[model samples]
Target chain A: MYVQEPIAILDSGVGGLTVVKEVMRQLPREKIIYFGDTARAPYGPRPAEEVHRFTSEIVHYLIQYRPKMLVIACNTATAVALEDIRSCVSIPVVGVIHPGARAANGRTQTGIIGVIGTEGTIRSGAYEQALKQLSSSNEVISLACPRFVPLVEKGNFRSEETYETVRESLESLKQRQLDTLILGCTHYPFLADTISEVMGKGITLISSADETAREISTILYDRNRMASNNELPVHHFFCSGEPGMFKSIAQQWLGEQIDLTPVVWQVPNIV
Target chain B: MYVQEPIAILDSGVGGLTVVKEVMRQLPREKIIYFGDTARAPYGPRPAEEVHRFTSEIVHYLIQYRPKMLVIACNTATAVALEDIRSCVSIPVVGVIHPGARAANGRTQTGIIGVIGTEGTIRSGAYEQALKQLSSSNEVISLACPRFVPLVEKGNFRSEETYETVRESLESLKQRQLDTLILGCTHYPFLADTISEVMGKGITLISSADETAREISTILYDRNRMASNNELPVHHFFCSGEPGMFKSIAQQWLGEQIDLTPVVWQVPNIV
Candidate 1:
């Protein structure tokens, strides 16, 4: 019965919508204020400090709305900026890595797990460390599916090119005999069916989007900050790049008509 | 890498073992320091303020060890005291409700969900509110199986009386046509088989303990607070009440020999 404030969710591009979809599925009544820094496109290839700066800047834009929570929906951004953003705001903030790692631990019976993400997420070894911390006995295999985000951004999840790239990237993991594979990158869930096909039905694919949405639900409930059930929710969308393409893809994925507002970045001087 | 510090976990009674069991399974290298306030067992019926005080006192006691994080493993304690404890400490603090709600949200498809918990949890309407916030369209039915807790405390989860109590309490929920049920109380997972039998295979059950453990894994990973993998983890257990019963039940549930430490509660003066 608390006041309903919009939750601000940001990602480098469309990858975070996988998270937004899950959040909407899990928390329908709560309004969402989403910003996709599509102008920056892929944060994966960018330096950690650059990702942090972009994340911080987007967060500053989001703060104007006074959101109740902030979700760093992009995996690369999350790896570099999650803690920094938590320090930036008093409201609850969450990212994707921990959720994916936790779900992978739960699903794997073979004690063998695999993680696939961008170069940064894989290179950072965040998933490997998290999996190891959870159970040192777990055999964690990580591979950077660097081609994945771009494929998803293009909305080519099931294309033949995607299949070849996915199969080639995951070919190494199949040899490891992993029973569970984590789509460490948020965008990867959009590629789940193809990934599942390549890995086969025997291997469980863990989506950070699903787990992150659940984590958000948990924190909101713990803080006595759940939105009231009385009103209909209005969701706001923004992207720094071409609104037409972003809107088209978002509508295709969301299965609804949406108004995507364009946001121009005002780079703030950092001390 | 951060220095390996014990992760502090607290519950009203032995129920937290479910979470500890998970933490141990997921994070094998991390040491655990567990405290079951068996002397002040069953936080379900207590007032929020009183529960908060007791939780704060226990947290103060646990903080002496300089734990790397705090896990509020009990649902009642978590619902009332999680945020306060987070405010009281600098180490990352986590709780059970959001995790439970998130898991249930993920599991439920019919939009009709059921929550069974202590009177305090049900009366607080935390689960119902959380579910609704996730999706206002969700029809959430909550029931207080107050009798279920005492049965669990006595380790009578599979007995006929426990079945009868579970059946009687959940009979109303069955009539509501729910596709998923959340074992909102940490003690309730112990009653899972009986509860499942009563609800039948049609409804999936969500365990707060499992979800909470996953959340803990997520937080530790995000902070880079993961314990080193090379060292063997040493787990310590404590109780303010009778250690014998607590130890026996814990050993049976964990399927491992554990050393149970007894601590005398020095009631701190609270303003």
Candidate 2:
């Protein structure tokens, strides 16, 4: 188990950059290899079988990199593919669901939790299962905010339109007596500030991206695979669609936080 | 391999009940077996060799129950004995230091962290090593408060005396520009309210007990050993000291949180 092997991360679109930014910030020494299936921007409305197939293709492609770990940064893919990927891969495979659920379980005093995700993720009931698996008594309320993902993918973070959109989408969730809310979708972290403003100060928003980065650190340390690079390590990024929009969004989102090398493959969805 | 096997946790004294409360709250279905070395309390002042030996003895005794996981809830003991226990045991062995360090690394925006623990833990520099292992740029400030453990073991949580002692012990540390302060010792969580009052709200207190419990859930999930018992499992507790004080403190600290059966072993230190 070489420690210098980069951790591989894959997502359906630029939303996974939320996880990338967090991993870079929390674990500065570890190298990363990221893949964004920009040709397949939103996997939320897709069928489960198609999402699973797309996820498997990406994992097989990224396997060539010999990553020490594989992280399914997209909640939709994770809902359908995390266990399948883990069964096929030898390295540790982590998803965004459990970490966010674990954080919600740990943080919520009232045991009433709210989860917001894409339609595919909500339909999968993965968050409810993950939360209840830890403790049987957690009352889970789930919502699928399909509108929020488009705003994040377009990098439209904060404005009057965005605020109203966020507030309207979270209309019913905020009325519930929940002490903790899990941002089950990786894209949701980009809209956290506006979401928090709409939800008020009482509800704590648990970001799976941030928690997943922390878990990556935990699993790496547990397996004795943590990197010891004294100098800053360079990260690699790849995309399947137009690098122009991907790179523009990536640069605007990551900015100076990432020391990265972009490699646009222009690879379409695998048949 | 049975999912019902208890998780064994040990601390120098009643300080570990903080971890117990969290584990019970977070993963309530899992059974617990607790050991408190109250007779030889305050592993803080002891030599590293003695602390290591004491920890080994408790672990050896707990081995009879065949716990699925072993948690060194005491920071001083964890610093001196975690790797040794991990090497000797087949089950997963967790320490309080690294989880707290990881949480601090994930939470801090300023790259500055503060750690407060017993003399033994502070001298061992476990938190510093754990914190820097993830990110080298983190500036760590550590302080040892020997007076804090005795107060918690004696069931003194909040009072003018407790508040004054906590304030005085953290006098210098509260002045730093740290965005996060790790409760590096298990006993420190008992004094968290006082410590937070003294340190003010800006400096987030990263409780090792809380983070350690959360990590325990993560590792169990990762290993596919999470308990699935629908019934509320009865928990067992043992302390190598007088039953009166131990039971009283535990009862007061745990209150209604624990569903417990206490068994005072009255076993003195091994030769």
TM-score chain B for all models.
Answer: 0.94, 0.95
Give the Cα error of residue A65 in candidate 1, in Å: 5.6
Candidate 2, residues B1-271, lDDT tens digits: the string is: 4389999999988889889989989999999999998878889999999999889989988999999999999999999999888889899999999999999999999999999999999999999998888888899999999999988888888889999999889899867899999998888888888899899989999999999999999998888889998998888888877767888878777775443444454564653
lDDT of 1 at B259: 80
Give one clash count per candidate, in the order shown.
8, 0
* Per-residue lDDT of model 1, residues A108-213, tens digit only: 8899898889998888888887677667778888888888888888888787798899889888788878888888988888888888998888888889998888
Per-residue alpha-carbon lDDT of candidate 2 for residues A122-146, written as tens digits (9 for 90 to 100): 9999999998988889999999999
The TM-scores, one per candidate, come to 0.80, 0.95
Per-candidate Cα lDDT values, in order, are: 0.84, 0.89
> How far in Å is the alpha carbon of B207 misplaced in model 2?
0.9
